[model samples]
Target chain A: MPFVNIRITNEGATTEQKQRLIKGVTDLLADVLGKNPKTTFVIIDEVDTDNWGIGGESVTEIRKK
Target chain B: MPFVNIRITNEGATTEQKQRLIKGVTDLLADVLGKNPKTTFVIIDEVDTDNWGIGGESVTEIRKK
Candidate 1:
């Protein structure tokens, strides 16, 4: 079984988009690594910008520039 | 640095609870794996029951039993 996680800034993505990501990642692993889609788990996390940090600065602060 | 993700069914977890999970996971990794808490990423995913599946059935469906 393979578990894949996709973390993205909570920017108002529609449900369809999340489903596509799940499908895409699952298909990719199945194609490249011979993984079974049935046993694969895809989780999408929509993190708040304030909760996501890069270079010691949160994404919320970085976006103010 | 370690990226740890915890997925749980969306069942009305408070903000404090989520923060506690983050802290608990970070400390656990630091204690057990010698990982740096500063750079450790703890992501908590609250998945909708309809989106979470098990044995070809979604959690929502399974909970009906």
Candidate 2:
């Protein structure tokens, strides 16, 4: 089973966009790795800007600066 | 920055349990790999039994037999 987890800053992605992500990721794995779509799992997590940090600063703070 | 995503079958996990998972995974990566905790990301996804499969059979179907 192949599990794919995608994390993005909570920037208001539409449901249709999320649906496309799930479908595209599943298809990509199946095409490249021969993984079964039924066995493949794709999860998307929208992280708060305050919760996600890069370079010792939260995304929220970084955006402010 | 270290990003960790944990996937488990949708068993009833307490909120406390999930909190511990987030903390433990962040700590593990920091202790083992010297990653910065401030920049570490831990996300957990619970999959439906019907969605997860192994050996060409879904977990839900396998449980029935």
Candidate 3:
């Protein structure tokens, strides 16, 4: 079983978008790694900007500049 | 750097609980994998019952039965 996790900023991603991401990632893994979709799990996480850090700074502070 | 993502059901997890999870996971990685805590990233994602699937059924449906 292959478990995939996608993390993105909470930018109001629609359910349809999430579905597409899940499907696309699953398909890609199936194509590349020969993984089975039946046992594949894709979880999408929407994180707050303040919580995401990059290069010693939070995304919130970075985006403010 | 180790990126740890913990996915759990959205069962009203408090901030302190999440923080503990983050710290614990970070420490575990450092102790076991020798990963650096400063560069390590721990992300906790709380998923809805409807979004989680198992045995071809969503967690919500499974719970209802």
Q: lDDT per model, in order? A: 0.79, 0.78, 0.79
Please tell me which predicted candidate would have the highest DockQ against the true structure. 3
**lDDT string, candidate 3, A1-65, tens digits:** 78876789987887666666767877887889988878887677788999999999999999899
Candidate 1: tens digits of C-alpha lDDT, residues B1-65: 89987889998999999999999999999999999999999888689765564433445655889
Q: What share of the true interface contacts does candidate 1 keep?
A: 0.02
lDDT for model 3 comes to: 0.79
* Candidate 2 residue-wise lDDT at A23: 97
Residue A32 of model 2 has an lDDT of 97
Q: Please compute and give the TM-score of the first chain of candidate 1 against the native first chain.
A: 0.92
Stretch of 10 with least lDDT, candidate 1 chain A: A14-23
lDDT of model 2, residue A4: 96
Tens-digit lDDT track of model 1 for A1-65: 78876778998877566656667777888899998878887666678999999999999999999
Against the native complex, each candidate's DockQ, computed on alpha carbons, is 0.14, 0.10, 0.15
